[model samples]
Target: MSNVKLKNSTTELRDLDALHHLHPFTDHKSLRSGGARVIVKGDGPYVWDSEGHRILDGMAGLWTTNVGYGRSELADAARDQMLELPFYNTFFRTTHPPVVALSQKLAGITPAHINQVFYGSSGSESNDTAIRLIRHYWTLKGEPKRRIIISRKNAYHGSTIAAGSMGGMGHVHKHSYPVYEGFRHIMDPCWFDEGQDGESLEAFGLRAARALEDEILAVGPENVAAFAGEPVQGAGGVKIAPPSYWKEIQRIVDTYGILLLADEVITGFGRLGTWFASDYYGIKPNIITFAKAVTSGYLPLSGILVDDRIVAALMDHDDDFNHGYTFSGHPVACAVALKNIEIMERENLVARVADYGAPALAKLLARFEDHPLVGEVRSVGMMGAIELVADKRTRRRFDNPGRVGLICRDHFFREGFIMRAVFDTMVCAPPLIWGDGEFAEAERVIGRALDLTLADVAGEIAA
Candidate 1:
């Protein structure tokens, strides 16, 4: 196509999007004014915008796409499945080969105790399923009153009503007014932000874990059904708890006999170098919610891996669970996920993250810790964060919480990379396929962005 035609197409697309597209978690007003960047294509770890900019996909397409982009094998899997069985509901006690095969694959890879799968089309749906499933399990055991599921503040589970209520972000909750009952939250283990002055990470971790116990006591243990959390708080600025955190959390949940729900939507399927973050953290959860990387975002698919104990409780009740989506166990999505996993295994992607990607990313991010505008640098597996601060010594934030972050994020885009900003914390989860070349480019692009952001926020730091 001619450059003139391409430019016209890009402009026309942007105009149409501004007119009709209502994006999730986006300010429509701002989006309309600024216009969204039109991503045209992706290959390996890079995406090309409509403007012909080749940028590193530092976020792995919202923490999915572990196998990177343009894998014809995944497309072929989808095409084959579509040709064979495009749409078949898993209702009426009916089953298909793709779903069954994927189910077995998931069960084999998940934690030992988790042997059953419940399907949905997104993380939000999966989490909503979890809420109902947890309550149902307790009710089956004759503890219907145990409905409250405790989570950490600022955590991002999903955007649906139930999932949003379960998450602790006040912004998300505001829109979900009269927020769903029986959901409570405690402080997240964001040591850099919430830790007491001079407190060690270990001590802060213990304190954070104890908060669950505190909330449980306040709510009455008998009334609490389970504790839910992401093993690594991905959307909450990649907040990784200290070493002591998950161990203590496990002990607390065990003590109270409440179920543990690990929301591994972002960290599952080798984002954290393990099949699930639960394994990485060494916590045995009763249920594990998974999505995103399961199919590398080739198609939307999400689900929960139920522990055998819960499955047994569910089985004891002879009636229907009365919960599921129309597209539950979608055959096409299942086929894509199966193929995605096959590629990951054949290429050893998970081990690649563990042995090289994680360490390399850590080193790359660490280089920015001494930047004038950076407060701290942290990473776990492929996930990473760089805290933008006005006062590094005092860990003080800019006046407007996300203002600096947005600025930095824009800088990253302009510098030929994509990085997400949670308030003043810039986070990235590059594809597992990223190697020395990607890391080298990231260092250059990210350093320039940071320097540019620092220049933009110099006045705030001075004040």
Candidate 2:
């Protein structure tokens, strides 16, 4: 009965939200007509809406909640820090204990020879910092003309102008303000879509990676500063590069003396069963931009891990650095992150991902690899994707891309699951705390959603 009243209140609240609230990446007109789903609470891999429906969160709140939802440890840490010292800026030569401890913890966990930390509230901010630091580093080294940063197409860095320019999504750039200059975009190593009809994966990967060399020379190596990329492209349909891709990328960047910046915002903090994708792939980038899972979505926190070589250059230059945020190292956020890491360590979550979670997810998702509706199935660590298609042999897309994806996305919610659809590819990156049971449930629900979508698109599919 209480759920009934709560549902009514939810309707009223949704009405209020439609009148005033503006959501990101949403079609406001359509949202106002359909109304918003009010999520009232969450507990251990599940969230309850106002109508009392328990939905399994497969995306883990935008791929951040590694420790899962409703962990009291994180809440307690935030509360304790709030009581002790809620607000204190890291600027003005004043640093708090939580920030200091977190810095040490981050440096210890990150790759060797990378000891400096710069804090921000989100990945966008950290990427912005990367842009400035890269340009400034070149300036300090007396080569201010080395301003161009190369990234891959279909990459997602962040939404800020600087970060967006660094990204390769032209549609996102068209809708937002004008993109800033000094950024180059190369083709991504998407073997499924970009590979030739008879080409091998390894051959395609090498060709795709060589595009970086082509771009650097086009921009002139003397003017190039860095090459930025997500270890695995998350928003770009959970695309996984071939094994040969990164090695070739590292080689080209090294040959040109350009900085390699790994954007680990999605693959960081054990998402890939390792501390960072840099380690998983055996590449040591000069800088790593991280956020999202750093605090397990418990609090907003993000930062960059700068190599000691860059730190040395900055120290010798003797400038203010002139970058930071009001909440640069907010004590409360650092406290939550510290606790989140502790929980992950105490539970051995990283090893579990390597030993159990990833393997189970791969085995489950592999069941759909040959399904008519699925063009491809890819999984790495806890993240995976099922690409929907109109014709499997040619990898042909739907007449209207993202239409079938929206249909499947709605079906996921109706069937009590939350999996994101990027265009026609359904992506999943569930919380690391999820086990075999949760994995089975996800497989069942997603399988059913695929069946329903297949039926809906039967006539459109080419037999």
For model 1 the local lDDT of residue 446 reads 89
Clashing pairs in 2: none
Which lDDT value does model 2 have at 451? Answer: 93
The sequence of per-residue lDDT tens digits that candidate 2 reaches over residues 1-463 is 3454455588897887897899987989999999999888889999999888999999999999999999999999999999999999989899999999999999999999899899999999999999999999999999999999999999999988889889999877986677888998999988877889889989998999999999998989999999999999999988899989999999999999989999999999998899899999889899999999999998999999999989999889757999889999899999999999999899999989999988998998999988888899999999999999999988998988899999999999999999999999999999998987898898899889999999999997878
Clash count in backbone of candidate 1:
0
Cα lDDT for residue 18, candidate 1: 86
For residues 1-463, what per-residue lDDT tens digits would candidate 1 score against the true structure?
2454355777788887887789988998889988888888899999999889999999999999999999999999999999999999999999999999999999999888889999999999989999999999999999999999999998998999899999998999999977899899999998998899889999999999999999999989999999999999999899999999999999999999999999999999998898888999999999999999999999999999999999999788789999989999999999999999999999998899899999999999998888989899999999999999999899989997999999999999999999999999999999999989999999999889999998887888844
Most accurate candidate by lDDT: 1
Lowest summed lDDT across 10 adjacent residues in model 1 is found at: 1-10
Q: Rate the local accuracy (lDDT) of all candidates.
A: 0.93, 0.92
TM-score of each: 0.98, 0.98
